[model samples]
Target: MDNIVIKQPRLYTPLQIGLGSFVGGPIAMVYLLWQNFKTLGNQNGTQYTLAGGILFNVGLLLLLPQLPSNFPSIVIPFVYSLTALSIAATWQMRRDAIQHSVHYRFQPNWRVLLLSISLLIVWLGCAYGLGIWLDALGIIDLDGSAITAGKDELSF
Candidate 1:
């Protein structure tokens, strides 16, 4: 019998997965928000937004390890803190809105839906663009490598 070799596809690295998730998390959040806004009405918007924002921040934190070391630590903390504050404030506002019932009617807001869709598209596009830019700058290689013949071989 003759010896034979087999090759298997490589899985994405942690950093790559994190970056991809970071890019996707916000977009999906926005879409869900938009859908909630369209279908659920204003009373539900604040609750949905608050919950979605928290989840988005958590996803961002997961991506922190993949961030470039050159990134400023202060920026991440500031953004995270701001997001947390916003969530808290929104929760409070929703509570007040529910209590007062000051003719607060729930209505469909199309503008917000449009904005959400646009923002999601822009965000994902920018993420992909950044990946390309990083590759161009040789900061990171988007295409991974495979082990072959007892050596690492770069894949295109």
Candidate 2:
């Protein structure tokens, strides 16, 4: 009997993971990581990654409103993006080296792009829905009265 090794059909490159993180945030990065784990046939990694990712994102959402008004907006994105890239570089790269060849085919870039866009839409929708719910509950008003008016109101 000979040892048998099966190559992955498709795997995402680190670049794709980084871009997905940049556009879709930590959740998207986690999704990509989960996909990689699933593809590699590591059921435990897939499950843990998903659970951890959800918890992290939930914590993040809860903590976001507590940030000081003076806090820089870019910091959060920068931190998550860097973290995702680091994981891709270290973990995924090691897996690729062992399980895949130099000529291995990666998942298409468009798939990442689509996922990013879809995640963006979902995030925006959730935010909007929350805002509406809060408004209905008298917690916050979604009206534009709080916004400062521009000098000129021209037709689009």
Quote each prediction's TM-score: 0.37, 0.72
Q: Which stretches of candidate 1 lie over 4 Å from their true place?
A: 1-92, 95-112, 145-156
Clashing pairs in 2: none
Question: RMSD in angstroms, all models?
Answer: 20.5, 6.9
lDDT of all predictions: 0.46, 0.74
* Stretches of model 2 off by over 4 angstroms after superposition: 1-8, 94-104, 134-156
Which ten-residue region of model 1 has the weakest summed lDDT? 8-17
For candidate 2, write residues 1-156 as lDDT tens digits.
598876646777777888888898767878888888777677987888889888887777656645676999888877887887777777665436634565346888899999988887776676667667766886654574433233235424
Instruction: Please report the candidate that would top lDDT against the real structure.
Output: 2
lDDT of 1 by residue, 78-116 (tens): 443344335434432343443354433322334334544
Clashing pairs in model 1? Answer: none
